[model samples]
Target chain A: NAGVIQTPRHKVTGKGQEATLWCEPISGHSAVFWYRQTIVQGLEFLTYFRNQAPIDDSGMPKERFSAQMPNQSHSTLKIQSTQPQDSAVYLCASTISAEQFFGPGTRLTVL
Target chain B: AQSVTQPDARVTVSEGASLQLRCKYSYSGTPYLFWYVQYQRQGLQLLLKYYSGDPVVQGVNGFEAEFSKSDSSFHLRKASVHWSDSAVYFCAASRTGGYKVVFGSGTRLLVSP
Candidate 1:
C-alpha cells in the first residue's frame, strides 16, 4: 500500500501569500490527521477528520489557518498571509486503528 | 486535557550500549501511550504502544516500553544500540474515545559507532 501521500514535497511563499497543502490518505482509512513540526514547537496537532467530517480543530490558529476534507481520499490545509513564523514541516497522517501512517510532509518556507 | 513530557531533549550513547528514554503523561483516566521514531527528513513511525495488559510492551527493532500508572510514566529502552537507531523519538498520549493525540517535545538520540 502507498500509505499516505502529500503533494509538493516543498513549498516556498512570500509573507503575504497564501499556500495550500494536500494529502491523500490510505484507502479505507476512517481517520485523517494534520500536524505541524518545528524545531521549537516540536510536533503540534492541527486538526483531524473522521469519515470526512471534522472531529476537532482546536489546535488550528483562528486567524489564517483552515482545513477541509472534501472527500475520503483527500484533505487540504490552507494558510493565508503566510509569515516566517509559519515555516515548518506540515505532516499528514491516516489511521485505521490507533496507529497512524504519515506522509512525506510538505516543508513550507516563508520569506 | 492530556499532555506528554519527554524530559531529555538529547541523548547520546556508544554503539552496543544500553539506552533508555523517559516519558511521563498527564490525563484523568486510562491513557493510551505510544512511542514514535522519526529519522532525518522522514515521517513518524510507530515503535510500540501501551494500552493495558502487561506493563512492559515489546516493539519493533527490539525496543520495549514499560508503563507505570502510579508514576504516569512510559519509558522506552533497548538492550544494545545500533547506528540505525539514531533518530528523534517522541512520546504521545491520548484518552480513550479521544481522537486527539498530544505529543512530547521529542528526544533526539545519537548513537556513535
Candidate 2:
C-alpha cells in the first residue's frame, strides 16, 4: 500500500523565509491529517481534512500557518515567515477508519 | 478535551528483561487509547489500540497493553525485551466518536545487550 508519502525528508529554511511541505495520502483514503512533532511537545495535531474538505484546524497556529487539501490524493502545509520555534518534524497521516497510517515526515529546520 | 500522559520520559532495560511503559489519560466519555512506536528517523507506527471489551489488547511485535478505566491508565508491556525494541513510544487518547487525538510526550526506551 506504500502507506502515505511525503516529499523532502529534510528541509532547511532561514528565519522569516517561507516553507511548504507536501503529502500524498493513500489511495481511496478520505481522511488526511497534519501533525507537528518535537522533543518537547511530542506530537501535536495541526489540522485535518475529510473527503477533501477541512473539518478541524483548531490546533493550527493562528498566524503564519495554513493547510489545504485540494483533492483526495494530496495535501499541503505552508508556513510563512518561519521562525526558530517552527523547527520541528511535520508528519502526515491518512486513515480509512480510526487507524492512521503515517508518512516518514519532513523535518523542518528554521535557522 | 482529552489528554494522555506518559510519566516516564526515558526507560532503560537489558535485553531479555521484562518491560513496561505507563500511560494515563483523562476524558469525560468512553476513550480510545493507542500505543505507537517510532524508530530512529522513521514515522510512528501503531503498536496496539483499545476500543471496547477486553481491557487487555495485544498488538504487533509481541507488544500488549492493559486498559484500566478505574485508574484511567493504559500501560504497555512486553514479556521480554530485545535490542531492536529500543525506540520512542507514544500514548494517545481520543474520545469515542471523535476524530481528534491527543498524544503524550512519549517515553524513549533504551534496550542494552
- Name the lDDT of candidate 1: 0.93
Error of 1 at A80 (Å): 1.5
State the displacement of the C-alpha of residue B94, model 1, in Å, after optimal TM-score superposition.
1.2
- The estimated TM-scores of all candidates read 0.97, 0.96
Error of 2 at A92 (Å): 0.7
Candidate 2, residue A93: CA error in Å?
Answer: 0.9
Clashes of 2: 0
- Candidate 1 docks with a DockQ of 0.65
Candidate 1, which CAPRI tier? medium
Compute the interface RMSD for each candidate structure: 1.4, 1.2
Which DockQ-derived CAPRI band holds candidate 2? medium
Per-residue lDDT for B1-113 in model 1, tens only?
Answer: 67899999999999999999999999998788999999999899999988889999999999999999999999999999999999999999877766667889999999999
lDDT of 2 by residue, B6-34 (tens): 99999999999999999999999768899
Predicted structure 2, TM vs. truth = 0.96
